[model samples]
Target: MNQPHHRPDPYTERPWLNPAISPFIQIQGVTKRFGDFTAVNAVDLAIYQGELFALLGGSGCGKTTLLRMLAGFETPTEGRIIIDGLDMTEVPPYERPVNMMFQSYALFPHMNVFNNIAYGLRRDGIKSDELKRRVNDIIDMVELNPLTHRRPHQLSGGQRQRVALARALVKQPKVLLLDEPLAALDKRLREQTQFELMNIQDQLGITFVVVTHDQEEAMTLATRIAVMGAGQFEQVGTPADIYENPQTRFIAGFIGSANLLSGTVQDCQPEKGTDDAPDTSRVQIVTDEGNQLLSVSTDRVVAAGDAVTLAIRPEKISVTLQDSAVSDTADKVPDNAPNTVSNNGSGTVPGYVSGNVPENVLWGTVQEMAYLGRLSTFRIKTDAGPTLEVTAPNQRRVLDNRHLIDWDDRVRLTFSSDSAVLLTR
Candidate 1:
């Protein structure tokens, strides 16, 4: 038998699928409003113990509002909040078993690091040797030992952030709520602090609820992400699940860059194969653009003529020069690949039609090009379909312009059927 891999990043899979633990925090049908406007809708969620959970969304999307409610700064206009098996809806912010770290870091300008950290310890009535030990322990935990005697203004932005973190953690609350905790730091510092924050969360085993609009931050910091839209959660899953298998068009577009093509289903062959590898329903969709055909494997049973959408990420599609004249049949692609499409099919995509129309091939002229350091991104304007954006890594250093896919160059884009997701929405 194979040994299981140690230290899985997101902890194997979604918490719902794991049978070992129950929810440590529960928000059952929670909603909040300011005047007539609803900031948070009726949302049901469960967060397990020691989880680095993130509430992600765009501005005015209710993520910060939800964090405020969780921290007892704002009461839910409807529903209840429970943490560590106790109802916290009406509990005052001071009494709640949670500490909030604001976006500003909110350090005391006059007080030095040690005093700031000790403020909370003193408030909790811990005195003398015990207080000093607790403050020292937390200061060391956040790596702010050297700055213990320095004032907030004397510290760098990152050190101030660490001090704020130390202050929040010194209390050792059951849950920590951070509102855009890393927003103020520079990109490089933010990236470095991401792992540092993750490590502290892991060592302390404290449940962390972070709110961020940055997708990469959420992906890197949290075990689970709840994508909020219009005051409600659209989907909750691990980073892979949210990126690879988004349930809605908004999610596909929001989580990452996606190419969306509208189409209509021509037919579906439901459950047709064998015992060992059961055949999933094969859906053949004709693009509304009138020149494309795509097939995908889906679990849903839908009738012909139903409207559908084909969603694929840029990296999933293969881009190449047109001289190969590769065929686009099912056999052309590897068995492991799905929904194969190509650019060699001259008439198949938008602009031109010819006698030898290759299947799954799209012919387009590069309208724009951007040579990003690690990747080259191209925007193609075709004669028949919508413009497509394709990105390919610069594996080899390009010394000459000839190696690059220049503007207005006729290039071919190919992709597997299974690589594209069929969405009814």
Candidate 2:
């Protein structure tokens, strides 16, 4: 049974994110090698039943090798793989209670869609009546009934992918392993197919382990992600956790664009409030540029003079054009302490209308601008010889050809102390 939690997510309303649920798949001390090359190191993982898990990493990062281990294609050099209270360490490819959909969609060119999907069942010596019924059911589920008569060569890339999926689903395996399943399709089809795959998994209630290098796809389709690197998992959590609260420097840079600034914790200020409220503590970090940043961390025992890193995303920082009278060199600004964002009764950043020197504002000149529709990315160079990337949204339309912090404009980039993420590693 699944545990109860209030954090309802879009992908699945079930609280599989709760750690209390018993694991359905466990990989313990698993290692693999090929000709002195360590493809996979000793890694431990736990995946719950009916969960869509993503093994996310770059090429040669051991994601596929791990999936192959789960599929019984690659025998582990040392370790145990348990699934549904059964040990599958010595299981063969065809005898294992799991199915693997290869990256190439490995369909027979001469066989039609129905025959391709029924080939497995036919190989098992099932009669034509049962095989025909199973093929039709999977074809209907995958919405490929119209293309059942078409051969692999006659089908499109997306169609071929669906055919492969239908073939894997026809057997109703306890777990389905997909290796770069959507890599064969174009961008448009891949985006549309991701949700389709998710819906099918939800309906079937089978645990899915997908290996993919595409971070966005992993974020979109996976219930939880395991970020792998150098044959070991760097981090494993929900997509939100991996992106928002990255543990290591590699995770911060690998998941998304993070502005990592070196700093040291100068102080830890605990909030002085009632017991009902969380014991929220704010840590102050002084950057290498001699500027300090404040961050809120709940579960760390931090101290003064401890080196740390302040990681913040690009979208969280706000940039506004400041006139020459109020703006000066970046280092010239007085810094008593790092300042956070404040509400000026209008619920907007201070000094948005008037040219007042607001807190957390830094002087910089726009060096480059990328005009993506609905969003604009600017590369701003500070007077202190550092470049901070800022992304601003176009919420309001301008009819008079007005630009908000245009090219070559001297701007003051502002970010709240709460936006700063403190990473000790």
- The per-model lDDT (C-alpha) reads 0.82, 0.81
Q: Summarize candidate 2's per-residue lDDT along 246-364 as a digit string, tens digits.
A: 89888988998888888777678776545544565667665677353445453466888988888878898888776642454333433322232332323342222222433356667
Error of 1 at 381 (Å): 2.4
Query: Alpha-carbon error at 30 in model 1, in Å?
Result: 0.7
Model 2: lDDT to the true structure: 0.81
Q: Whose TM-score is greatest here?
A: 1
Assess the local accuracy of residue 114 in candidate 2 as a C-alpha lDDT between 0 and 100. 90
RMSD of each: 5.4, 6.1
- Report residue 375 deviation for candidate 1 (angstroms): 0.6
**Per-prediction TM-score:** 0.88, 0.86
Q: Which ten residues in a row have the lowest lDDT in candidate 1?
A: 350-359
Q: Give residue 161's lDDT in candidate 1 (0 to 100).
A: 93
* CA error at residue 280 for candidate 2, angstroms: 4.1
